[model samples]
Target: MRSSISDRLSKMDKRLLNVRFKKSTASIFVLFIIFIIVFFFHPFNELTTVNLQSYPNLVDSLKGNTVISDIKIKKCFYYSSCQLNKVEQLQWRRLDSPLELYAAKPFRSLSRSMDIFNTFVFVKQASAQTVDSALVDVKITLKGEPINDSNEGWVSTDYDSYTIWKKFISKSHETFEQVDLVRDLDILFGMDDLQDSREYWQYQRTSIPVNAPVLPHLTLLKVPLTSHNKIFTEFHEFQSLKQNEVLLAKSNSLKIVQISDLHIGPDTGFCLDSSIDCTADLKSLEFLESSFEGESSSKPIDLVVITGDLIDSHRTKEFKSSILKSLSPILSKKIPFIFTFGEMDEVPLYEDKPEDENSPDESDLKVDTILKLNILNFISSLPYCYNKFVRYNQNLHGLTNYNMKVFKMPVNEETQLKLDEPAAIITVLDSENHKIDSSQINFLYRENQPLKSKDPFKLLFFHYPLPNYRPQGEFKLIGAYNDKKPLKKKTDMKFRDDIASLGYQVVSVGHEYKNDLCLLSEKIDRNTVINSMWLCYSSGAGASVGTSVDYDRKLRVFQIDFEKKQMLSWKRSALKGAFDHQMIHEY
Candidate 1:
């Protein structure tokens, strides 16, 4: 009448129900182990996000701002941080040990701009390669915003921002995309010797942008997202400070004195009279230096600009050494050296005396001359025939008769007489403009005879004159060649017109020792450009000044006053004596 003993036993076990629970638990344990393996060794997983659509909509406010307080980062989704306003219990993220953070109130700017409290922490995380929990041993600062600075040059901020973005990716194989926000800046905050390429503010422009109305206090937390969005930002308390601004200054009516061609040598009175046996040459320099020092006027010397030709010649090493020593007196002053190359400062391409075949011996040339000769020979080899002919001229013998009489005068003279005319120079273009004619130097500003007075101070310096001069003074003693035949081709029409067109008030020249300033004028149709100063001064310190030249000539010194727009000139005895007589001329 009964089924079996085994069947009854099975039925009894099922009724207990505890036996059924054991089998179900064992199956779940197996599945849990499989899940643990997938989580630890998987390459990358679908992003995990806690969807919370109930948060306050602050997207509109965050359109421009980098950090929006309305969205608080929680477990996974952004929460309604707006409702948590006021001193309400706040969630502050701790960065490290030395730093602290807090969120308090809203900040307001004078421009009526409003922004939530934004805080930053100045932490010395020496190894900021990767973010970690323990390295969070830093602090979030309450104040201390980074000041803006100019960038020296450009650099690559690509790798630097890549460091902060690396922690977000889930898989090791995934590479982070370059963020343009950080790519533009150069991350040169610490290292030196970067030269032009450098960035002053470290992470300010990128991650921790100062967008909102600067809050006072803030906290820096390392709480990261699930290896997808590695965001590192600040949690801050809002406090206000009366913001300040900066101002700048200006300078007006800046005046300066430009003095050039001040060939101050030891021999001020080297070339004077053959009969009088007196000294006077370069007499202007002594008075010029003292005049600048004596000027007790307002704005005496804001700046002393010197174009060039300040020295006679530092040709010999010994001569150069002496000059450097003497120059200390002037250079030690506060005057700035605004200088450029002059025809004399640098050595001449051609020799003062071309080598002569009449030399006592062929090897009489110095080692320097020999080296220069080699260079000349090599240059002659070029295909251009110009340099070959130049080389031929350079190698010519008795190149010039320096001892030849440049002038011839009567045996005796009483009144002031013409001593000697200037050397007949064949003008060559200066080093600046190579193509300038070498045969003609007619750029002198004095074409219109001679003049009496000039309104403004004008000066002209060059290597030649517009026309040949008749011999002057007594040259019988020195014995030199007189003026050569007039220029083969009539005076240059182009250069003559150019000089006459210049509206100069005064012009100072050094090449001629005519000791005169001719008031010149050119008839330009109905109008006339004339009466400008045509100053041809006398200075040949290292040479003789002929038979009848004066020992006490006009050592002219022109002074200018920009305030009143005036000019005062004087002449001295080259001995820094009272300008003896000052011609007070003003404009």
Candidate 2:
């Protein structure tokens, strides 16, 4: 043999050069122990020399006896690969006292190498006092010089921006309790309107001043009044037909499952750094498990609404607990969902702080009051689902309007009359940015004069879409009155003829992400007649922002039957390839 095969190839090349010299000395001793813990134990340096550079004459200051009045910057956000394009010189100014002041001058450079900007500001605080040296002084400049190394760029004083003023100074000390101001003026007015709320209790006692400084009540984010009386006794197992209880009809077919503008937080993602995308939370829990787990779906979702910008402008509590843990399969399958808010569901109302710096409760409360206490503690930790306890008035509209009933029954037991005949009603409201508030149209015309008569199947659920259902010079302006003759109002076709004389034969909105329907005729009387209603518009299940349309990103559904009261179907499902629901119109 050729010298015994060259002695076994020279002992296999010295055992592969001693395994590549012990993997290059363990990768240079693990990059020199990560460069000696990032430069001699600087442990990622800059602990606090808080300069927070976003400045316009920097003033956030307020400290103890609290009194900053106004700041209002509103937006600076940028980070979709930071492209601002224009804005050459923005400015703002106010300073005679109510401070204000903001500047920006752009064209191209808005990001000094952008490392997260955020910036919504809004300050205001004259009393609900927890000042804790309210601070915020940033100051950086470039072509107008002044960048002086105030520790050159690293201001983060463990900020949650004073935990959104410590949960609005602990809910302004539980709204200065006197039994929560008589249960917030009995959910606003009605003891024959309690002397019309005496100018709302003199505007809440002259905006907090019975010797000011109030902060405590944060009972570490309370929530248990025995979990709101066990969610009002598990919302009477969805009140089978409460008029004292029983009348029947829990389902003659309703379905629904809407889900619009679900811009599920951390500004959702198609990458480009909006991060968190466990495959967009597994495609939003695979579209609520194929709309109530469809095996060729035969109708089971009986009600799940959502209808709003369920977050997109970052209302972080890990973006509302990753959109309620991707709607924990519609709250662990006890279905019956609801919610309405939108306008980016209490948008970027300032949050920043949660890279886990030992987060016990890094409180940033006020993404519309921490999304109404994380939706009343996730609908009182679910499990008992029948559904009713959605009262929430907070003086009529703030906690996003309410009222639901479905396929109801209870009629004349010598007319005890609780919810006499409701074969389906709904009415969620809170049309966030297409605005509303004429005290929410006089609290939905006093809760719709006790559910407007028979021909039931009402359905209103809002989140905008009324400026005569958008498109056509996109109208908007839903409220305004004074400012020395302001006027505004008009939601046109006379606000859908006052929600079609409060009987609402379907409204179902969702800030125009696309999917349409229309119908909406007009003339509400004066004999000239006309009528019609519908409206529709859902298109948004998240991730379809500027274009890449597939019907803008589906999710609608509808259904209804109530002994054929109308609308037998509706569609537009598509949340990624063949999930299909596609019909868009049905009767």
Candidate 3:
């Protein structure tokens, strides 16, 4: 009876085990079904089902479908007799959209007829049909224009055309109408009733009459409205010395280009002393570009120095644009550059007003200070400009007074570990007031106190010639001396002696437009030549400024060999080209 009972219990246990195995198998099958559903049928798995071959087309469809095929500017004389003349047709790059608009030719009012004119901007746009449908009634509006239900499909850009137009008009006395439409097309009436200022009209009577009608200097921009597009307002493509201080120390030799007296104005510049009718600003830019192109491959330019007179302060209403235009070549090449202030640079905007208004009031003073600060901020903000990094001493008489050091390049990784010393030092002083005061002298003495032991090659740069700077003296002269009245203020001999005592080898300046001489003078002490310094001058590069018509616009090039401790300079003429009047100095 015990054996029979045990057999029945065993049979029950087997049945229970079989039932548990079947239940576990059914649960596993349910989980597999869920996995299959998630892997192939779930909404999140749709990405995997898309064909890889169509990915590029899918991306293209998502991008901006509108394309700006062409942009043109048309000038007209009257509203009734609208004879459109295509003044400019910009060839824009497919990758780079334009950020600013500039006039290649100045818009002048008809002097003889005295008829005011208007300008029209035409933009040819093309659009691709989207997957949903065609872009229906696509419209575009300039920046700062009002957007409402009437212009529901209008696309807006990042630029503010209205503000830019106002800024441009502030520089001139010509009255302008608000930006309006000429027709119900892709045409914009940029400037309306554009008349010349009374000052310009009087000047035109004395000078040769310009036959063109008055047109506005409006800012034009062609940019994509897509969210992914980047707006390039500054020189972001170029590398700056401030970001890469090692750029100067990496090479044993350096080539520096010195351009001066740009005299850039708000409008396309007028010919000052030129015989032929030409655009001065455009010509000046061409000269600058030629100078850069004249540089040899073996001796490429690394630094540029503009010794003041960057803008025509008399017409400084559009100084920001003028400054940008003047520095285009340097900015384009991404070369490091420095500049000093000329007397014109310091002229207050209110100084041109009437006698009572000429004396700056409190508000005028504030405005002047703000303008100066804005200019300084703008210049310093440029990627390749070094003017902002200049150290200022309150005790000094002028702004932009500082010193820079160029260190010797390391031979290898091991040599770079050693204590680095400056191979050369450059000191820039402000002689804008036409004299170097005792405070600047004291500042120079104090700054050089620590560097006395190292005895590096010291070079000084300023705007005006020194008090003792004689064109023809016991010194050697290398270039032209056409300035009948050399701009030199009276200062004590102590300043000259201090420069020699401080071990300054080269003292360069730029003020006289026709003077391009490099005078080498020796400091004699008791019949012994104690020290020698090169007093050099850079000629005016702007055609708008007063210069000898016979003398072509030129740039001064200085090549410094750190290893040899020598500097070689020469002139690069606009008409005659480069390699003229070469001069050298060994320290």
Candidate 4:
């Protein structure tokens, strides 16, 4: 009877456990169904739709309803069922275009060939905006095209025959009436290149080519012809130097930093001779900024003279960019600065050729002149550039030939005195060809006639050292002279004698990278005592050029004291992080 009762109770407990499992399973199933219903029919979706409805134009744009198609077609045809293989075969049979023929047998220098071809297209477009837009479109269209290897499809005549470009423009026009093709290359490429058809647009300030060896197809851009189009201008506005005619200083002394042989390239350049890995351009800039920071508060840097070689030769195509990069540190400091042209400043890096052979295109004088003019226009347009555009002689051999007056502050700080006479004069000349021409020398004398009466302390700056600049008898040399031989032009003594006669006391130059010698020598005329001049060479500040690992990159600093009529100079080394071997001379 006891066993029968226990079995009945156990069966009743099992029934109760089964009922609880069924209830929990049914509850979870109901919750899952409710979650699905809430997720699909959420109020957040309706709120998003309501917000988009308020901006109809935005909704249209998001749905690809713009003037130009957001979806670019690889190849468009009038007929929907047009066979691509048939059209490609027809294009292959077409005669080779000028561009295709040029690409087949490009110039020795691939970069030069690309530059010429792109320039031709730019000229044909005749509008800066159109050219820019078209180039970008071409780059996009030929995105996967091989740069090193030739693609037969791109080398066909039909590729650049305006068939595709015309079709694109027609399609764009059909959709939108606001879009139109216009010619306007005046701002960047210059209208003069169009007017003077004899000269090609070699120095047009455009970006480098994306693809080389294979010529890119020409594409007509569907630009919006509206008043909303803002003309693209340079980042910095043109700053005149008239206000800075007289250099001002904190105290009685004027400090000038001479940085030379920057050899700045397109981007952060590679170190040519450095043992450690570094970016040449960045290191040079850091050295300059560090030197500026290490300056004495009482004698701050008042003037900066970048002697020359601001840009590297092999990469002269992007000289505008390179120059801006080189001068960034100086420009940031807001110090008044001047520039002189080096031999490599305007010359492009040409491929190796036989000494006796000559290529007409590579050695074209017109192209060279255009490049120099373009470089000058760019540099002169920058802010705080003390380069004056006024040329004493129209036929002056070089572009950067100008003079600046450095005035002395009154001893009494309380009294505002109007001083008429200048304490010193700084003359900057261009020795781009490694020699100063007779025309430049004559212009120098002509421009100095008025200021000659002031009898100011005259200092001259150029790129190349003059022949036999060192004194024969006795001279004091300061700093290292590690250069195998000073890179001087084999010119007559006329230039040296002329400047010496003009009361020039110091002739500072930059070209030899390894030499930083400052020699004070007497300038005697026919056994008679005359003024003593300082012939100084500032070492190369750029690491891209050949530099000694033992010697640190440096900048030559000049501090002129008007009261004492004295000038103190020293080398500010990058490794040393301070001034070294300070030398002083009284005028």
Candidate 5:
């Protein structure tokens, strides 16, 4: 009986031990699972720094009451001369970091800091899970103002704050990439300090550590402007008709936005709002807006080429002002644009003012010539227009004729622009009288001389389109001017051939006011290799005969791959109509 009782007691004790063992195993499994969740979801690993400890005290301080400390903000203006220090030490404390403290250089400065704007903070990730494994959450405040969407004091929390805040995401183990914050800042306030409260300009960035229990908690690190250096760097200013070159991006693509025939004047729809049917100015403005909007969404407009006829027949000062005002909304974006003259821009020679007391006979006193020169000067003053060529090429009948070379810019600070092979040659030719004179052709040939051996991608811009030789669209050869005075041979049909022989892959023209893209296939070296020369016409933008007929205004955007010596794609963006757009042609 004693033995039986002992056995039963032993069995009960063993059962209790088994229950405890099972519970312990379950607890260990739960802890392991929790640790794994923290390891994968929460990335609280120490960041490695050069000339500094692998583990920073900021991580420990994150556990305490203090949010963050030991951060310095460096400020510098990015004018033509500012140099950005790209050292490894300057790469820390990104806005997305749990305890971020850094200053951003200004983007572009217009005359010192008048129109200066620097993206202050680009916090991609605001949360700890978004930051590091140990970090739970982080809050950003610019100038003692919280950036949360609930705050209506400093930021516009109504519509875009949430979206902008959500765009901040963890880019890598060390940094968070902020995409839309800069744009949000631009929208909320004006681009620079002057737009927002000027008083807050001094206070740049502040970070608040929200969670982490070990070190000082809620420690705030205010990164002030420690230093601002005004350093000058070498930059090439826009020179005269002698080749103003631009760098071709790594993609080997060149995008040209053609806005043609904006016949803005007092008579157009802008000044005639009372007449709803005569809303040409309004319609023209809408078309420009559409074209620009499309460009902003798609690839950036590398070069905006205005193919003549910017003004109407009524060349009054008021009309010119009205025209400038009408175009201000688009050109104000500061896009790089070049100009060519059209037939309508001409004021008949009879309308010229009396000659000056000592005006030379060689000096052109024709109203048309004077008007063209005055208009050229006016556009040259504009921020976007690049007509420096007029300053030097005063001998040409049409001062607009010149050439610009596009050079490939280096990939980084260490690399320099490649001057050996020009990426592309833009030949701005003069065809104001629907004719290309031998002198003009010779000028073009001279421009093409230096680039002859390089075999660079060539693009020709003028105001007239090649004559449609096909039977279906048989049209008079209008690309050249014919002398009304009796001459043995009148036709300038060889103009197209001359351009083709010079190896121009594309010819862009306006005047026609029609959106047309066609290939001029010609045999090269009389071999099997056929060169398909692209001829494109940008649709009329303003009130003109073409705009009146059919009323489908558009901007033609050409995307060319210079490396391949072929146009990758071409599309016409309609200003108005049921169809958004149709692909005109593609390579």
Candidate 6:
């Protein structure tokens, strides 16, 4: 019986072997036929029109016969008189981040995939009729390239493309200027040239420590100009930047509350009234009320200012109003309100079509495509916490006629602003604008003249600090590969010489959303006693990511001791269980 079973099994094995050989031959033939069909059809071979017309920023490249073949840069701090000749590399690789945006992100950012293997450029509007619209379409053609699975990747948040472009601008500032880059340019590339970040992002999202401090380095920064199209360091290296201490009071009799980075509704996950279904704005306000612990005091807030990014996007009027109205009820307590614009609140200067009411497709675009031609009204329409945010001291000793008497001035308007009482002024100035140097409001912060006029002390409010703050023409950073973003062409000389002409004392700003502080210690060219002051996101109310060494994240609170003539900034880490937020003792 065993012999018979073995014979049957051998026969079955032979039949199966024959069938397997025949199947293999058929499969090979089928594959050959499919290959031939694909070769003849060549359906995926069609060129993809880049619609260079869609993005006008490339206008600078229009005059380029010689494209940006490669770039090299060596940059340093603006104060380092390191002479242009010593930079060694004309490449802006060493230039610090020229273009940067500050706002917080959700603990969990949505991983959305974006195709970034495309070309982009800045261009000027074609005609006068385009002024009101803030955008114009250009007639330009672009070479096409094919995309493969490798070109697409999932992004958990807005990919900051402007950040990437800024790196390019920073790295090749010399090369582009030397090449006579026009207002627009074209980015032509081959199919294999497309780059991707899927692997990079995957590692970042899965790797942050749960108990980490929300330092600027760990947070993600998205460019406000281009569609948040680039990604930089996620595991940011943290550092503490120390500054000179200023004592506000001998015994401490003043209360200072810092409400920071209140980016009104648009472009971020924290933005409420948007599609993300978040109440971050409301929550921030609620948290603030809790922080303050009560309503209008017989003693008004020592000083108060929103500190830039009053509105998330330049054109989001209704959204901004919602934020203002919500706060109006609180300010009804008669507390002072002051704020400024971050990169998001200002009109974007990229060369592109000013998408408007007529252009429904672009009506929802975030950037102000038409740069110089843009309107301040769109920006002015939003509510700023104060007419100005400044760096100055307030005197509390006076005849008791009211809760608190706050005296200040605004750069945008001429009238002297008097709020019920101010805990402190976090001035938000438009550093990009050249006209602010002569600002009458700034004179108050520098000199104590306003304090002499019945008021106990005189203070000021404006965005971005002078002297200490680099205050250079806005540009966009450092990355693993190289310095990614660069400044716009010929945009550098716009600082210093212009500032030397405008004399002022102290200034405070909030575009940097880290919890701790990085105040500039440089004294004004004219004044030795007064140092230009800048405190980045002194209070980490927003989830904006920070940069390595220079910034980080934490919820900060500023305390005032007027008698001592100093302000103590206290920051508590929201990420770390530790309550030690950090101290910017008196910027």
* Candidate 2 segments exceeding 4 Å error: 1-307, 310-313, 318-338, 341-403, 406-420, 427-453, 456-459, 464-531, 534-587
Per residue, candidate 6 scores C-alpha lDDT tens digits across 57-94 of 11222222222222222222222323344343342212
For each candidate, give its TM-score against the true structure. 0.29, 0.26, 0.58, 0.56, 0.50, 0.34
> What TM-score does structure 5 among the candidates reach?
0.50
Residues 284-340 of candidate 1: C-alpha lDDT, one tens digit per residue: 333344544654243333333233344444321112221322232233333322222
- Candidate 3: residue pairs that collide: 109-214
Give the Cα-based TM-score of candidate 6 against the true structure.
0.34
Residue-pair clashes, model 3: 1
* lDDT ranking from best candidate downward: 4, 3, 5, 2, 6, 1
For each candidate in the order shown, give its overall lDDT on alpha carbons.
0.28, 0.43, 0.55, 0.55, 0.47, 0.32
Candidate 4 lDDT score at position 258: 89
What lDDT, from 0 to 1, does candidate 4 have?
Answer: 0.55
Which residues of candidate 3, in runs, are more than 4 Å off? 1-250, 273-276, 348-366, 389-393, 410-420, 452-455, 471-473, 484-490, 548-551, 580-584
Which stretches of model 4 miss by more than 4 angstroms? Answer: 1-240, 243-245, 273-278, 296-298, 347-365, 389-394, 409-420, 452-455, 470-474, 484-488, 524-528, 548-551, 578-587
Candidate 1 structure, TM-score to reference = 0.29
lDDT of candidate 2 over 1-587, digit per residue (tens): 88888878877777787778788889899999997565444412121121111211001121122333223332233322222234411222221110001111122234422222333333344432433222222221212233344544323222222212211123344433221111111011001101111111111111110111210110011121123344445454444443232223335666776777756543223333344332443454456566567622565565677777765644232232344444556765656566666766553223444545442232433335444444434433333222233323334444556666664333335745446455666667665446665666677677667764666666777776665554343322211111222223444446667777776666767666644454444444575556555666665665545533222355666666655555643544553432423222234
Candidate 6 ranges with C-alpha deviation above 4 Å: 1-253, 266-279, 294-300, 314-317, 325-329, 332-334, 348-428, 432-461, 464-467, 470-506, 523-540, 543-556, 572-587
RMSD of each: 32.9, 22.1, 26.5, 25.5, 29.8, 24.6
Residue 192 CA displacement from its true place in model 4, Å: 36
Candidate 4 on 380-466: residue-level lDDT in tens?
645556765431223565678777777665534574423345677778887756777787788778867766345566788988888
* Cα-based lDDT at residue 44, candidate 1: 23
Instruction: Please report the candidate that would top TM-score against the real structure.
Output: 3
Among all windows of 10 consecutive residues in model 6, the one with the lowest summed lDDT is: 236-245
Please give the ranking of all candidate structures by TM-score, highest first, separated by commas: 3, 4, 5, 6, 1, 2
Q: What lDDT does model 6 reach? A: 0.32
State each candidate's clash count: 37, 2, 1, 5, 28, 106
